[model samples]
Target: MARKLTPAERLATAEKDLLLEEIADQSSWDQFLVEQAVFHFGQRHDEWSCNDLRDVLPELGHGFLGAAINSLRGAGIIAHTGRTVPSTQASTHGHRIGVWRITGKGRAIAAQRRIARARGRAA
Candidate 1:
């Protein structure tokens, strides 16, 4: 058995999800490109957060980096470093975001991708 959401809570959830989708769509880069950019970014740094990633990525609207980061996290490509830093965006008002690092599995996969990419180029 589960408690149902109140009408107000449901509406808030819908609105928040809508805003998230809108921000994700606003990016000039598509979802795969966004994911790829962040994935490769992890290879170059030991630990990073959206604040650092923002410097490398293109204009992604508000909080647009989250979906891509979450995707990688879900796939076990990265893991939280058990650290956090205040978000630079004024909208977040200094709230914290997790710092993350690539895992061994992630590094192995990245290496495979690099080899495949180089082979593709050589062909």
Candidate 2:
């Protein structure tokens, strides 16, 4: 079983997430989320819906998430896996929502961005 987070650790994580969101630009934040989603959703075996992502990234505004989803879809970075899952949002309790998975192209782009970020920090 996974260890539970201590209160202090949870607080620190929340602070860090907030600070990162504030510092990052929209595109950068979106890209970061795309990479994060790969891990968050279990890659190819699992998929995430909008609400799922929202739950994981509460710091991101709805408008930002919507735009990011569209942009990634357009760029072929993410695609609907032709699957639908029950909505997790309270407002849409019974509705089915689209499921998305990262594409190979998306993974490639994410990898490149991750490398660039690492290099930037190193420099």
Candidate 3:
């Protein structure tokens, strides 16, 4: 069993959730990032990190992609793969970063989106 969150921790969690929702609502970037990360990298590889995501996503500013990825994980779209690797960014001095993989839920949603896109194009 895990320790329950304190009031401050709970408040911080709520604040973060609201901010992530606002970021998603403000533009299409969040959805695009999901597609690019889930379909692009998630399809070709079994595991990835923000390094891989940042490589493909040109629009998100520093820290934004990390936030988005956290949101995705919260939504059950991706999960830690029980692996870690040194970040390729020289700025990090090879710090360890978590590896992640798309969850079944993520793959299902991607398939549904693909079908919808196909139908839209057909129509």
- lDDT for predicted candidate 2 compared with the true structure: 0.59
lDDT of 2 at 32: 46
Model 2: residues with Cα > 4 Å off, grouped in runs: 1-46, 121-123
Q: List the candidate 3 regions with Cα displacement exceeding 4 Å.
A: 1-40
What would the TM-scores of all predictions be? Answer: 0.70, 0.56, 0.65
Candidate that beats the other on lDDT, 1 or 3, i.e. the better one: 1
* lDDT per residue as tens, model 2, 12-56: 242334466553734356544554453335344456788777766
Clashes of 3: 0
Between prediction 2 and prediction 3, the one with superior TM-score is: 3
After superposition, the stretches of candidate 1 with alpha carbons farther than 4 Å from their true spots are 1-29, 61-63, 121-123
Candidate 1 vs 3: which has more TM-score: 1
RMSD of each: 11.3, 12.1, 9.5
Q: Give the alpha carbon lDDT tens digit for every residue of 2-115 in model 1.
A: 464332232223122244565465433465456666777888999999898887777853345787778678777789999999999778899999999988877777666667
Winner by TM-score between candidate 2 and candidate 1:
1
Q: Output the better candidate (2/3) by lDDT.
A: 3
lDDT per residue as tens, model 3, 2-109: 564332232223122245565565455555445445445775688888788767765544456666567667767778998998887879999999898978877676
Worst 10 residues of 1 by lDDT: 7-16
Report lDDT (CA) for all predictions: 0.69, 0.59, 0.63
Q: What lDDT is reached at residue 36 by model 1?
A: 62
Model 2 TM: 0.56
